[model samples]
Target: VITGARYPRLRRSGWICFGSWLAIAIWLAIVSPDGSSTKDARVKNCHVGGPEKYQRYVLGALLPEVDQFMLGFRLITSVDPLFTGEQASSLSNLTKTIYTDLESDPDFHALGSVMPGAYDELWARKFDHGHYFLYVPPGLDHKSPAPALVFLHGSGGNFKAYTWLLSRVADECGMVLISPSYGMGNWDSQGGVRAVEAALDDAGKDIPIDMNRIHLAGLSNGGLGVSRVAASDQGKRFRSLTFLSGVCDAAAIATDAFKKQWSGKPVLIITGTDDDRVPLNHVSSYASSMRDSGAGVEMSTYDGADHFLFFSHRDRCLEELSRWFTRQLAPALPSSKELKGQ
Candidate 1:
């Protein structure tokens, strides 16, 4: 967890790095390399002065004009996550509110801030000596419940590393994405589990999250973490489980009682035949053990794919995974309302 001590250094370096990248990307959209432009050159000639001055125009009055120009054009397809029409407008307004809240709220500033983005994809905040990064789908209904996923990253991964793909998934699936940073620790450790729980609670407070649809997912060490968490009593709360490149020791965690409890719940295990780090045999064996114990488990395999196959087969994986997740979701129950402290 980044506290008051490390927070400043991270904020200074992290936000600035992200802000610098954002300013450059946005600036490139407003200006051409040859300095030949038809529209007013207010933003084209403006100099970037760190995060606070990122929006300053040649003339103060031109800022709104630049905003309009940006809103009007589709500068870059990858950087611009917002959709067209009313959805884009709603997301823009929500983004503004989130930014203002992060900047003006003393509690938020002292805790953490949003990860800067041309579209503001994610936010980073401290939790249990670790950090929890979150993304809410643009144009999410505040009054209606939306599904949420708690994603655990592998040993060498961080929140920023996976936010791009996860953000896209959240937008497509209408799910809230919560990724907890374990700071080099394995996710099954006591601290790791607590951090994940903290992340869920924090994300729930920020949006009208549907607890009934809450799902737990992980990759690599994260996949191992999912197995451990799902075997515990607390796992009963989740509607489903998705494992990517994950293998676990069935004897150590998946006891008879655990299998009995998970028998009715859905479990989707995705693996690659060519993943040497986690062999297909290990994952298949674990799945077999869970099935023998009466758990509802499904396994999917990709050919000619390695440990990093998800990166290569992203679209296919997301489409199938999204379908699996959608099928496992349960209708909002009365108890789900309590998850939001309503």
Candidate 2:
């Protein structure tokens, strides 16, 4: 009887030891120094497991707050772990790249920390009604009011990343960047219009915004909002419109009232050929309708790119947008001769 009990206890202990060693070995293989497994690959592969597990081990191991935030974001956005579509894959890969860099790179992490605080100051001091992210490029002040580019975020909650990425346009083109946050990013109603107008009003109070130079832009579902807002009574406030990886409502834009409101205004659209979410053909057709409706519409298409081309092909998109903005501003700017005369 004593020998039998000892044998069972020994067997249990042996199995526990084996299991521990096996787990350690698997961990070592995944995090080996030989470069077989990389952090980027781990971040990109969502099917391995949920972001919770991945965040705990790989993504935000250094910053617990960031880890928690990412987990919350995943939940809010309803990111499917098993989603293998091109748009999902691209968005996942880009998001992972950004967070992983934030975790590993000190400079990026520091910028990420400082940006939110600045936005908080704006929200606390000036805007108290609605949520928004603002970025005023260097050298812009009350003495010389800068042009404003108001962007509407797509579904998946309004991320600071959108504002951060768009800051390049603000910096390059000397424009103020303001992105208004709508709940769940549904901006196709009266509330959406109010949110945008309220943000503009709040921002205008502190920052000198050139009302005539304001441009409205949107992405994905935001494109729908853009169409609705642009056709509202306040639609005349915007000087131009831009659609990225999105399209305007066909029925709305095809109306006589919309055409009358948007006539002579320049519109820029950039899209990808392989975007499964927003098909290229649909975008082209929308552009035709906009053009027919008297809006000066220009469309640029990228080859083999997907819905997340705004992120995947960031440089090209920004550069093109910057040039387009400059072109629009050129006509409004006083000629060299006029300046000399002044």
Candidate 3:
């Protein structure tokens, strides 16, 4: 009797609840530690509370799924130091860039719908001790024996968004995409190398991966890991290596051991001219050393771009990568004598 009769105040004032919620929303929109106005206050709140704070805004957005996906990426980078020894706050500029792009680009709103099953597929499968994300392109099966691209992520926690983004390349090039995750993204360690190998082995068992056509690629700190893995005894398994906004170890690349392993293999270095974290000169020097050591080196540099170019310049980057894979898989030309019926 007390439960039903004593709640008269709650039942009589529905407007009170709505008014309280409205007040809370107004306070969140107008207040911040920086003491700025509405938009600036929200931006400052994002910086103070991390990208998770963006969730409140995302809930009110038109494309919640795409906003959520972008939020996941911002959260990951906000917690880890992607610039090797730098602090997580070093990604502030990148976060701002993402926010700007999302507001201005209408096409970006449709990113989540591009690959139908990408989001669910990435989260559904767990392999190699739950350290990898595997994606098999549509129309590919055990009968096709498609090539594989093993991608390594940079420092920060690994999330499905990366595999989702790279799935475009896999779809276009008709290749299987395997992304292996290492704790805090320490891919330069033996454990990291083992994780990659384990993922490849496990994926190979379930899919038709052309062992000889495997390619290795990494981003940011992952680029350093790529060098480590390519220099190991397992190095001979990869046909090509790609680095995106990554720095190569100067001492390691100069050594005879590393040169011997990657000598004839194709190396692609994609970087930004204004990348202060991983300077253009450093990457250029690494490319020169690899080329001098007899490795087939290709360098692609973008002007006025920074370390976060992978996200900002996504389309061009994917196109270049897909083209590179096609070049690698192209059949050799027939000899002139054979053409002449000799």
C-alpha lDDT (0 to 100) for residue 138 of candidate 1: 57
Error of 2 at 125 (Å): 25
Global lDDT of each model?
A: 0.60, 0.69, 0.67
Q: For model 2, how does the per-residue alpha-carbon lDDT over 172-262 read when each residue is reduced to its tens digit?
A: 8889887876655667755778878877777776568999899999988889878877888778889888999985678778777778889
Worst 10 residues of 1 by lDDT: 41-50
Per residue, candidate 1 scores C-alpha lDDT tens digits across 1-342 of: 668998889889988999997896677445412212123211111111211222222221223322432454334334545333443444345434434534342322222211211112122323233346556665777689888888887754342435445556777788878776664436665656666766677666656888778898888788766777777666776887788887564653458656766776777888999777789988888888777767688999999776655566667788887787666663546676697786
Model 3, TM vs. native: 0.65
Arrange candidates by lDDT, descending.
2, 3, 1
lDDT of 3 by residue, 202-287 (tens): 77766788988999999988887788778777778899999999867666677787789888879999999988889998998889
Candidate 2 wrong stretches, greater than 4 Å: 1-90, 100-129, 332-342
TM-score of 1: 0.59
RMSD of 3: 12.3
Model 3 residue 41 distance off true place after TM-score fit, in angstroms: 41
Could you give the candidate ranking by TM-score, starting with the highest?
2, 3, 1
Instruction: Give the CA lDDT, 0 to 100, for residue 317 in model 2.
Output: 90
Candidate closer to the true structure by TM-score (higher is better), 2 or 3: 2
